[model samples]
Target: MSGGVDSAVAAARAVDAGHEVVGVHLALSRMPGTLRTGSRGCCTIEDSTDAQRAANIIGIPYYVWDFSERFKLDVVDDFIAEYSAGRTPNPCMRCNEKIKFAALLEKAIDLGFDAVCTGHYATIVTDDQGNRELHRASAWAKDQSYVLGVLTAEQLAHSMFPLGETPSKALVRAEAAERGFSVASKPDSHDICFIPDGDTKGWLGERVGIADGAIIDREGNTVGAHEGAHAYTVGQRRGLNLGVPAPDGRPRFVLEVRPKTNEVVVGPKEALAIAEIAGSRYTWAGLPQQHPEESFDCEVQIRAHADPVPAVARIQPTENGDEFVVTPEIALNGVAPGQTAVIYVGTRVLGQFTIDRTVSAVPVGV
Candidate 1:
């Protein structure tokens, strides 16, 4: 429940609907004074107690489920590894796929609960053909379909999002007030859930250590020595302290990160554009029987908070299955690897893709 207003209200609505509901708070190991306020701080013990209080207030039983070991392996380790490879990984999406849907959902069913519910702002709908499709919530600004694009049909079959139709965040808080839940006015946590301090670079430095690296210009001249190559990412505009000034007196941006040679390449603003993205590790929730390549025209979101834009995509042949290559209608800026690429057809979602590689294929002077 994360001790948040949204989940508390979700529980109340479920119970009022006459569905048998029990609150399960996931206990991720972390000491007190370390975790911050908000729904994402589920690792802290205080949030666990708050969850229990919410359950008691709702007159339902609650329990803490320890999944710390799995979280470190599935979410934290992979987060460090991906950054080390010069890619930015979305830990929340990984946590949902590995911990929430696969782990927690199965655990709920095993414990005899018919379904697991959350406060996610998205909806699941069955069309005339009875195929499940993920759609955006009425509260478009608060919609979280991008993070949840990884869910499979089986998981959605036994999952519920109670705030899907609650068009306003204010309404949710009001409901919480009426119910007497405590965290109605808590500020939302914007950082990654596990790393509340927002220190991804420090976390990576501690885990993988630093790789001696140099900041090089596009022409391959060593201009500066970066603390580590993994500390930077493609299209980064700040933090490059190059000793030399640009020849044209224009601000330079991070054009690429070469993990193989431990190099941070910086160049002019024009160089930070990309055209093609090939994403691996695809998990589609409501995809049709036809190949992803056949599902050609769609909208793709390269990251959360990114607007879904029109694109022409194809499933490129890979050894395991296929990597998706999407050509956006316009060149995207700062496209990074290790981020999820979710495709959508308006409100109906196509699926999700883990970006393996991206390239700028637009011909110069076009």
Candidate 2:
């Protein structure tokens, strides 16, 4: 339940539906301390107590499953590795893919459970042919289907989201209050669970030690020096420490972070504009029969909260599986490698893949 209002209400609704629901709260960290206040220090001792209280109120079995080792190996290690390789990764998506759906769902089914229910704001629909499809939530502002886009068809079959139709977070909170949940007004967790302070760059620096390297302009002239390339991401501008200014007196942005040479390449903001992106490691919730063709039209979402843009996508079969390329109608900025790119048709989620590279729109020697 994550000790949140949404999950408590989801448990209540599941019980009200007369389905036997067992409340399972994942213990993702080995050393979960009560370091911060509500929602900030999630999965901590206090939060688990709140979840147990809600489960007691709903009159269901509650258990805290320790998945700390698997979570660290799959999600935390992957996050560090991706950052070290000069790519920005969405760890939340990785958690959903590896821990929540794969590990937790597998264990749940083995324990005779039909489905694993979550408080996510997405819907699962069954068509006339009995095929399941994943759709966006009715709550646009609180929709989290983008993170769940990594789910495969098999995973979607045994998943449930009770708050999919809930119109707003306010309504969820109200429902929690109505049901007398202790976490009715608990604030949402905004920062990453492992890094509760939200200093990703600093946290990465501690693990991957600083590698002194030159920060150069687009033309390869050294402008400044940085501790490490892993500390910066594409399109970041605030902390470059570059004393040099562009010839045109315009602000510079991080065009690329090259981990191979430990170089930070800075250029004008326009240099970050990219129109084409190629991705690998694809997973589909459900594929249309006519798809798997050379090319088709779809909406591509580069980030979680970003709007999906109209694009022409090309699909290709690889020895490992399938790789796809997306060409947006309009160029986008800050599209980074190792970040997830989800494909959608109208409101239904088609699939997603990790962005491996991008084709910049800005020409060389411009």
Candidate 3:
């Protein structure tokens, strides 16, 4: 629940809908506002207190599952490793995929619950073929379909997102208040659950050892020195010591970050455009696939908050698993590995792939 207002009210609405609910606050090894976890603002004593109180008000049993060991390995370590490898990783998506949907769902099933639920701002709809699909919330501005596009077909079948249909946040709060829930006035967490202040590079450096690397220009000229090659990402514009001059007074962008060579390459903004991305760990959340040997043309969102880019998706064999390659209509701005590339059937999310490799192509217009 994270002691957030949306989750608390979501539990209330579940009960109102005549579904039995259990409140679970994932006690991850990393959360914000607690030095023990090196967290900036979550999973502190305050959050658990709020969760317990909300459960008490909702008349449901609340439990804190000690999944810290699993969380550290699955979410936290994966998060650090991705950055160390010169990629941006969304821990929230990791939390949703590995923790809430997978781990917690398993626990709920073991505990004899018919399904699992969360306060995610997205909806689930069954298609004409009876396949479960993820949909955007009525609250467009607050919709979180992007982060939640990684759910599997089995997971979506028994998952509940009560607030997704609740369009107005104001009305959700009002309904909570009318139910006499104390958390109706609580504020939503704006920062990541673990790294508070959003200093991703700093957090990464603290957890994993840093290595020195060079910042070079497009023509292989050493323009500056960076603390670590992994510290920079595509579309990044700051903290470079490049001595190169821009002919038209245009800004340089991150052209490449070769973690294998510890090289941070910078160049004109035009170099940031990418025509293709390779996805790893592909998963389908709609109809159960007949075989893992599948590929199709679908719109792919290379990362959360990135608008959908029409692309041709193809499945290829990877050393570890299947990889989905997406060739978008236009070159993408920043195609970072370790981020998610969610596939969509227009508005409905059919499946997703974890970014594994990025292919930089010059923007056509540039």
lDDT of each: 0.81, 0.87, 0.77
What total of clashing residue pairs does each candidate reach?
0, 0, 8
Cα RMSD for candidate 2? 1.7
Query: What would the per-residue lDDT of candidate 3 be over residues 297-326, giving only the tens digit for each residue?
Result: 678776666678777777778778667778
TM-score of each: 0.94, 0.96, 0.89
Q: Is candidate 2 or candidate 3 better by lDDT?
A: 2
Q: In model 2, state the lDDT of residue 96.
A: 95
Best-matching candidate per lDDT: 2
Query: Where does the lowest 10-residue lDDT sum fall in candidate 3?
Result: 31-40
Ranking by TM-score: 2, 1, 3
Pairs that clash in candidate 3 = 31-39, 32-39, 32-40, 32-41, 32-42, 33-39, 33-40, 33-41
Give the per-residue lDDT digits (tens) of candidate 1, residues 1-366.
Answer: 877777899999999999988888887654444444455555467677777888999999898888887888998888888987888899889988999888898888897878889988999888888778888888889989888999988887887888999989999999998898887786665577666576778867887788678888878888777888888988787888788887888887887788889899887767667888887688778755376556478888887788888989887787876777889898877888888998888887778889888775433322
- Window of ten residues with lowest summed lDDT in model 2: 33-42
For all predictions, the C-alpha RMSD in Å is 2.1, 1.7, 3.1
